[model samples]
Target: MSDKEIVEPLIPASGSQKIDSATKRGRIQMILLLLVCAAPVIASYFTFYVIKPAGGKANIGELVSPVQPFPSNVIEENLVGKWTLLVARPASECKVGDDACVTLLHVMRQLRTAMGKERTRVQLVWLVTDDSVIDPEIAKSYDKELAGFTFIRMPRDLAKKQRLMTWLNADNEQSAIHLLDPRGDRMMRFKTGEGHLDFKKMVKDLEKLLKWNPTGKVGD
Candidate 1:
């Protein structure tokens, strides 16, 4: 046998390995993007839930555990961009009077107004749960142009309507005023009192939220 040295050839990386590496990179980038988008929301929650100011009491509005994301089938574009205070009532019940339905509407309107200049950052949404004709006076009073209110009719489709009801009545308090963040998550619920509604506490909670989660634009 001749004294010849045998050398092994170096192997190149396999296609599968390259693909796995690329996929990992893509996933990492996506995760980072999500974190960036969620940072403000996370920070606000942390401030409200974890770092309580001295003598600061718990939130007046009950926090919806795990939070309910706004149903995409139900006026999603309107809800997603701004902080929303939502109330659900049938048009038949929301007449121009001092009824519970009208009271809730007033509460939502005042809550937004209390924000002052930051009022524009908030949106009042009245979800009419039925096809009953809205009172013309009520409509005139809450005109979108003047009062900055957006009225959305409940989805006609049975499935879509059910999903919305499930979210709105998560606590079985369908008449409560719900709070939705800019990202469209229903995080808080304010229930009615004995023939009254506490406007001050609600204003405090809303102010804290606006202070902590200030956004420059509608969708920001």
Candidate 2:
């Protein structure tokens, strides 16, 4: 053997470095993807949170504090398939002839119109707080308002949680009108108060959320 040709064998690569590099790349990619997916939702929230609409124009709707993230299982089991929720805070049943009943019905009509062709996806739910049984005739009449209004009788726990939500006008803006998305998520809140609510704006935003997160739940 020639002394000049003598050479030691080269050590093989450990592959550990390559694996770690690959892992780091995967994590970075995942983070980037998450940020990209969340951009629209984050932007919408910023529009509502950071931007203060100039003047006393009165945005109408109020912002809730400590933005909540609902669990998918719970929302799916109970809230999905439910679109519009009209929570009546009065301690008694809402009969058709009463002032409260009239106001609620009208509000629902406006909500339906605001949704336009997507009206079918909109649903109405009445949370009866009292022990009194809902008059069958009154419940039957609710069917006429739109194709998807439903009346659900829930206990007080439901009301208390909602009460804890952020206030839009007064501390007690009871009997809320919630616009639930197709995935049964509560994104838009409405009121029958004196000032006007921008239902069209809300509907437009919802349409965007639906498109952006087509397979995932809103606020996910």
Candidate 3:
């Protein structure tokens, strides 16, 4: 074999190696970028879930192992930049004197109020789960302008409503209050009942979240 032919075969092999190396480097850079964006959220969650504080008090709300994302088709705004506290109740169920429903609404309001100056970082979302018109009185009570609460009604399309219901009731606890992180992941849920809900612990859980994730936007 001539020297020219030997060198010609080696050139293609060298070029192929360079292309493979460049592709790998590109992949690595992309992965690192994603990790950098995810680190803050992962670290905060690790602290809350794995590394307990001195007293060893775990989160009162049940943490959703893998958080659920907001249903984009149903929610016009995916609530990307705010921590959302969401609850689902029919307008009829939330009538003025209904104690269970009333207490649930009251707790939702107080939870945001408890955030104090951090309250703006949090949003209260009420998902009205039925077609019945909300009482003017109840609607006025949680007026968006006055109370900073956003009330979204269930989609009239049965399939869309079912999808939303499935997301909201992932734990099969339909009445529980769900907490969605700034990136729009439903990360934790607080159970509410006649007397089972622990208001103080719920407040602490929320306070810790706002304290740890102050920016109200993931990877900030």
Candidate 4:
């Protein structure tokens, strides 16, 4: 055996092997590219269809979708530009010691106080079906329990004329408290008589809303 036979000549890599390696690399790169391109779309579809995050809102009250617009009088009364808790009650029931009115007043006060400093941005307002019929004792109670609370007169005639209750989805019963965002759109309804009004829950929800809308509170 000569040196030529002893030292075998170096063989060039087989074209098929090179081709297979290149094909594997190309396939890997293509899969990576596809994943990069489709990741967002797949995630979005899963989030929208399967997760449905928006449907899991934490608010205890019924969310008033398509927030109701405020009547002109409400706007004029300065209901806008501040988060409002609208308590609708017939004037006849607002008498002092009236259990419903008393409970409502206490809850509204608690709700406001629970906001801490955010309380400044909140206002508790009463919508009376007949202000003229309001008992003096109730007025005094308002001064006591709800010192800065606002009173809006929405007599039957005025409510019908301005479509206030219609817009607010309110009735003569004062059993529900309507929540309005700073934009004056009615957003939520917490019913009282049905053991549905959770003061702590309302406070937490309002705090979240206010936190999200700090510099110019707006809501849907």
TM agreement with the true structure for every prediction: 0.81, 0.58, 0.86, 0.63
- Poorest 10 consecutive residues by lDDT, candidate 3: 4-13
Per-residue alpha-carbon lDDT of model 3 for 78-158, expressed as tens digits?
677888898899888888888888778788888888988888888888889888888788789887766668888888788
Candidate 1, residues 53-117, lDDT tens digits: the string is 52468768887767788888655446777888888888988898757778788778888889888
* Model 4: lDDT of residue 159: 48
Candidate 4 lDDT over residue span 1-220, tens digit each? 7767777689999999999999999999999999875443344234333553446555566666555666765334777677788887778777777787778877887887787777777888887765457777666766523555777776445545467756655544335788776666776678787577688877766666665555333221
lDDT of each: 0.80, 0.52, 0.80, 0.67
Pairs of residues clashing in candidate 2: 84-123
lDDT of 1 at 163: 85
Tell me the spans in candidate 1 whose CA falls farther than 4 Å from its real position: 1-30, 216-220
Query: Measured by C-alpha RMSD in angstroms, how accurate is candidate 3?
Result: 4.7
Q: What is the lDDT of residue 166 in candidate 2?
A: 34
User: How many Å off is the CA of 200 in candidate 4?
Assistant: 1.5
* Candidate 3 wrongly placed segments (more than 4 Å): 1-13, 217-220
CA RMSD of each candidate after superposition: 4.4, 6.6, 4.7, 13.6
Better of 2 and 4 by lDDT: 4
Q: Is candidate 2 or candidate 4 better by TM-score?
A: 4
